[model samples]
Target: MKRLLCLAVAAASIPVSAEDRTLEHVLVSVPIHRQESNSVLPVTVITSEELQRSVATTIGETLENRAGLANSSFGPGVGRPVIRGQQGPRAITLQNNTSSADVSSFSPDHAVTVEPLLAKSIEVLRGPSTLLYGGGAIGGIVNVIDNRIPRERIEGIEGAAEYRYDYAPDLNSGVGVLEAGFGNLAFHLSGTSRSTSDLRIPGRAIDEAALAEQEEMMGHDEEHEGEDHEGEEHGEEEINNSKGKIANTDTDTDVITAGFSFHFDEKGSYAGFAVNNLNNKYGIPPGAHEHGHEEEHGEHEGEEHEGEDHEEEEHEGEEHEGEDHEGEEEEEEIVRIDMDQTRYDAMVHLYEPMDSIEVVRGFLTYTDYEHKELEGSEVGTRFKRDTWETRLEVVHNALLGTEGVVGLQAKSDTFEAVGEEGFIPKTDSTELGLFLIEDFHRNEWTYEAGLRGEYVERDPSTNAASNEDFTNWSASLSALWQFDDNWQTGVSLARSARAPSTEELFSNVDAMDPEELVTHAATGIIEVGDPDLDNETSLNADLALQWHSANSWAELSVFYNQFNDYIFLRNSGEEVDETAVYDYLQEDAKFYGVEFESSFHLTDLGPGALALDLRGDAIRGDFKDNGDVPRLPPVRVGARLSWTGDAFGTWVSVLNAGDQDRPGDFETDTDGYTRLDLGADYRFSFAQERELLVFIKWKNITDEEIRLSTSFLRNYAPEAGQSVAAGIRFSF
Candidate 1:
């Protein structure tokens, strides 16, 4: 590792292109066909070139500690992105501009379904994007774009494959993506498989919060220790907590997809369809999720030899367990997540400029998704969602003296969850929305405006107040001024509203059920819902300033959001099912934050140019009467010293997060920590215009014990310890 570090920083004379560090990357997720550096809203585009070098098993881990992003992680297996301090129903996750339709938004323990290995790029839109997407994007949207539908025809055959291995978790992953075309027909295929063993941690995962809850779990440990005399208490044994490792956090993931498209070849008219499926099985953090028989499973390793003698009989018994009421009672059920999704999408595009319309597009998608919480062979809970969505948009060259697009969208989703531990009630949801957007440039001023009206209805099988209907309107207005030759400024104002989710309205039934059953897996507290919760309304104002050039760019944004009826889940200082009770409540709330991104190129170095990239964000969340809102991300700052070389490139960064002392009611304070991360990649041309890329990334190099203020399971499972990941990719 040390020698590799030397090779990374040591300058080798390889001419590097300065344009590689420019901000001219075209962003496909931009509402308007504008470059990222000129977009009105804050958009961060992680290009395929960038993502390939920093890909991870989970999105949260992949983006953790970024400017305004954090991972609400439940061990290594489960991590959901928390954007600008908002998660769950507030942030909308998307794939190719459509909802991911996964359970990750339903619970913090759930994992995001999309695979990064197949993505061409990942776009993150900051702040409210309700007019373009929907009310669900009040927080923001993350769109993962891939060639699932073969938007463009390939000349012949082109593909990419990658193999990766990580040291910390003993992980191995293989990925392959192929694109081929014959005449006007194009086909795309991609697949990835990944598996990992238990993750090693810096310590026993014993933080202050864990220490407080350890008393209740002492008995389980004692019982297992009594089963055998391993001399763990011997004089030669190490006593430091670092000797212990995080348990039950292993994961295995697989994804496969196929797509085909037929194009006009002459005109820009094309139609395509794609099918994709994902299967993932991963363990929950040890203490956070447990099956009653902790001692039995804990000592299984010691008893494995004895169990092998009876393995044949045990296998036979499992087959006939239906006949025996209490079959194989000794088999310990491991708490894990088993999920799969099969999705189909079809899209049509016509670019033959009509008299008034410049382009016309239609999109339709159907998804069948299901996930389960498994305890041994029995499923503790099962969740199923079936959705059909359709959208049509018309882009006109000139409309009302401005260039703009009008769109109509409709969707129907049926969600059902059943099992002993299903917390939220089943519901059927439908939505209809009509939106219009216009943007025009006049002299030194650029103006944009949008309006959207949506109708939403939620019906629950149970007659609970969770049933609801609403017709809401959202609008946004923004204006940008060319302050100078290379400087621009803009301001935007919006009125947005969001209806309650089934979980927020009907979850009154669940107390984080498993959190109570498994003391360690607790999601901080038990949460109940108020069916009478009203829609949340927010008025937002944002100001942005930017300076852009060929080799440098910088942007700073400040925003303030005021809410009349802010719905939230708050700890009520009570107990339900042996866990602290949290109830869905509403009150006046306010949020203010600042986000900044900038990159500057210095003088040319040996064979490359040196650049300093910097970013940071801070926010404060509060209620009118209540002291503070819960689970807000910490104030953070980070910087990267980058060197762009022709064949060899590297960047080293240090990220610092301030301590979170102003926790919400019933919340605990978290200590702050600093982390160092390093990345190095070398590209070699094996053939003309074709390259093989080899990269190495080292994360948490100092092996800091990080407890997230935004995650409920932080105390139980800190982030992964020091890890070294290396991978090679072949691309044409």
Candidate 2:
């Protein structure tokens, strides 16, 4: 701890003027379009340059360094962001202000479809501003903005291409984009391809401590198996455990997008459409337990020979053939997911549409998405979702010294799952929402208020499940005060409600019969849902202070949320068919957290301008009636030092995660870990106008073992070890 503080202090003495200024002026697009500093909410915007430098295969990995964010990784291919100790359905992911339309929220092993490399800018919004998207966004929102719609007209043709390689995973990735404009019409095309081998780790793939605990328990159980010789001792079994590399962690992905837009009315009103297709094949690391078929086959065989058939089955050739076939199938299968999505989007924006409206915007999107979970050569389960969504907003002119936006959003989707792990039946879901927001400005204060109402309905195809509907509403109010020349403070309060999701209400497991129970292969648990689940609601409060000067900027925020009928999945202390049982239940819960981020610019101590960036975040969550919330992220703190010149830049950063001693029920503790990384880049002009840039990065130089508390696969697969990544880009 002392060494970490010393490094932070030394790094804090440097300065970077250019980057600080750029961050101050960046605009955030969610809720409303406004400058980051001018808004009453907590917002973080990653510009194109910053995004290019830190882009990763998953959105969670790309933004994990930011304050208040953690990556809950399933493997190298799947990472979902956990915000302020909230994840899954609580934190919403968007693409250009629209839903990404993926089933990532349904399970931790599923991957988000958004590609960070293709984004022009990424915006993160927290606090009351999240109400504009959905009341369910109690945690936060992530929106990836791309140029596929072409909001502005370009005069000429421009394009860029880049390639990157990483040594640890033998990853090779490339991206290309091209844009052309002819008068009022513009065309855009882009593509990206990424492929990686199995992830490499520093030591054994499995956590030995966790494995030992399991074996010890098993040994105790085995000791009482034989009453005739209860005093006899047994030897431990010798198992072959893989080392250095995590098997079945490879991934391959490809994306293609084409768009065209036509600008008219003096470039004020433009309509455009874009088409995108994505295909990905990724592996699940061993121990994820994709054995839905194996369990069923074993149970059926056991039931068939329960009585006098035991002796007959032992002598039957057909029974032996059946056993051999099942063995072959098990040996030939490796669990993986093959996913694809085709999306179409259209948008139109109008300025000064009427006397009372300053701007009007409309968006329409249709998506066809499907993913098949493969158990070796055969598909274990196939999940499909077809969705269409539309939204319209009118920015009304100032009235009574207030300005705001009124919006309407509607979405519909049909979701289906087939084959062995299909716990939830086919369901059709529909949602409609109406929202209003108003902003009032004063000499030293800015006040904003918003209200939203929504209707959600789910209808299942099977008669065993009935239709469910909900009416939900939310409200928020916030005020920002500029108390001093370099200091500002904000206070916000909100009440948000979220309706139950399809899976939360419709997971079908026959509790009466163990053999008939449904098990989710990805999680290795029998999950049962309640049909009478109520809406989950929360009351949130936030306070923030920000200070800025010529050479420094800092922000501190604290938030608390109290929930009524919080929805959570919990183990029921029951086992059926040799699998644990989990049920979706509601209980009162509370979460609170603090986050601090600061950057200091100092005089050039060497050949280039220097700056220091420091960030830290901590969160705690627990149920009011009982124990701590499960899988909460540990406290984290980090620091970075960077030096930049006209053509060259270099940076070093260190992040440390505190020990997670408060692991929830049935969870194991995770030790603390510190990671260090360094990178350098150079850019120069060539061919009179074109530019070429080269960069190199060394990640996890210390090669520490990192087991994320928020990850379901933490005990089986640690993060990648020491690796070197290099890339080059050429633009014209």
Candidate 3:
């Protein structure tokens, strides 16, 4: 790791020309209600500029680097953001305050349908927001804000177009965006396409040792070559040195979106609609060689064994042939395992104020989503979901102002899995919640407090007996103190909970191969309809300090969280026939973390100014006897130093992650490593009304082989190494 840091420093010293400086920062702004009177939750906001500068391909990837957040990748095409180590249905994803209807909650193989390129801003809300959103948000919420509809009537026509390209490891990608506005109406449209072949490690070939171990598990011998036929001759070189393309390793994705909105004359009144479509295809890596042998033996054993007397002889021959056939089949299957996914979403939102009361406001949202996946010869699975939400709130202006809000929400989902034995089911749920908040501000001291109550009822389509109902509540309090003009401190405490989703309670399907096993349950250990499967509750606390001086700023925060009856996946200790069963269980757990960030101007030697920024996140967690959770991101630290001026800007950074020792009952230990990246941009002002910007970036500077602990492909191969990309943007 020290050597890796040294390499990164050396790479950062690369020369940059004076004419190459440019502003590459992304600028974002969104309308938000004042938090003074209604909400005490600590919400973090990330601008588009911050996301654009990071070497991230997806929205989840961009958020994973944030403090107290973890991201797990199923492969190159799928990633889910984990808040304080909680993921899946526990964390909610919202596009413009509406739920994203993608099948990402059901499986890791599916990709999120929302596009990051079109987002104006992304907000992560922490604390007790579950009352308004539902049981799925015990952890937190990720909100993607986009402006596809006009909030007011436009007097003239206006439009903007943007294009970007990136190159990394063995992958290359491009994106295009277009937006226009006319007469009280605005429309947004965008298209993005990307493709990547097999990735390559920086300084190493495919981890042959790891591959050999995987082959052994599959029951294959290392001495065998590619030959499977009896009496077939094999070359010594082929048997001794195995080198070839890795299996199930490719990715391709495309997306398109179109949306429009209009506004009325009344203040705080607007309505808009949007439509999004996405398509993605990726490969699923193959299992070990031994599994292949058993399958081959089973397939040809009946045909090869003709008579009873020869059955014994045929069995012996079958063993040898099966092993060879398995080896060959493993290679073939890895390259052939392909899956495709398609999704569509439509959403509408309206916000207005009552005429009788200037402090009273109302908001409503409705969304419809459909998604489907295709794997091999199977028709895959399909899901359709609909959601509607309404909220009414009144603001206060007096001392220690009082605010109250009441909300109602409903969600319905239908699922279908087509195959030999068709499986079809559906779930519908409705929730009602009420909240009140009070804020007091005097001199340098501020205090906030809020509470919420929610009632929920879930109904199942296929199994009427599975219907369930419950009520839950959450509350929070926070205080901030201003020590001086440049210094401030804050502390917050909250209690929250998460209710089980339909997929966790009543969906049973075969979703894995030999090496990987997945089992859904019709009823969890907590029991459905037991009236006792209430929300899983948690307590959270945070302390933070911020300091700002002329040309510099810094922040540090520490947080702790404890959960009672935490919903987690664990080994059931019992196998059905020959397959392992992992049941969703509730247990106690704890998590703690500290984060620090700072940015400062280093020098003024250029056209503008040179700056340096440092940031890092460290997290640790304990699970009560259930073992550590699978795919927990390891502690990571990174820093970037850049020189920014009028026409040119350059930056270099290094990232390091500690090895992960926490493995679930079915997981393996993952090694840690470091990576380096550098980027620069240049701008040219041709005409007063026209400007051109060019960006060039180099990732994995030293091409170090680093594998993320939270990656599913870590066992087979690490992430891509060094690569370069250059693109040009024009505005007029």
Candidate closest to the true structure, highest lDDT: 2
In model 2, the Cα lDDT at residue 105 comes to: 79
- lDDT by residue for model 3 over 1-732, one digit each (tens)? 232232211111222122211222121111223431122344556655444444355667767666556665554555677776666777778776666766566554455666676666677765445645666777778887766554455444443345555554255566555566665566766666777664444543234454444334323343233535333422111211111223345677777767666655545345566555566666543322111111000011111111111111112221221122145423333322223333333433334344323344344555455544333444344556666665555544443253333344555444443333223346676767676656577678777676777776766665334677767888778788887988888898888766655555554423223232322111111111122354688898988887766677666776788888776544343433333344455678777666665666677874777776666666556677654555666766676778877788788777776677664433445677677878888878775456677887887788676666665455444565677867666654
Question: What shift in Å separates residue 552 of candidate 1 from its native position after superposition?
Answer: 1.1
State the lDDT of candidate 2 residue by residue for 227-291, as single tens digits: 43212311211112346787778999999999988988783788999999999999887655531
Q: Cα lDDT of model 1 overall?
A: 0.70
Off by over 4 Å in 3: 1-42, 126-128, 151-157, 169-174, 202-246, 266-268, 287-373, 383-400, 403-408, 416-418, 421-424, 463-465, 509-533, 664-666, 686-689
- Residue-level lDDT for 475 in candidate 3: 79
Weakest lDDT window of 10 consecutive positions for candidate 2 = 296-305
In candidate 2, position 131 carries an lDDT of 58
What's the TM-score of each model vs. the native?
A: 0.86, 0.90, 0.78
lDDT of each: 0.70, 0.75, 0.53
Candidate ranking (TM-score, best to worst): 2, 1, 3
The order by descending lDDT is: 2, 1, 3
Model 3: how far residue 289 lies from native, Å: 14
The deviation in Å at residue 18 for candidate 2 is 5.4
TM-score of 3: 0.78
Error of 3 at 126 (Å): 4.4
Better of 1 and 3 by TM-score: 1
Clashes of 1: 6
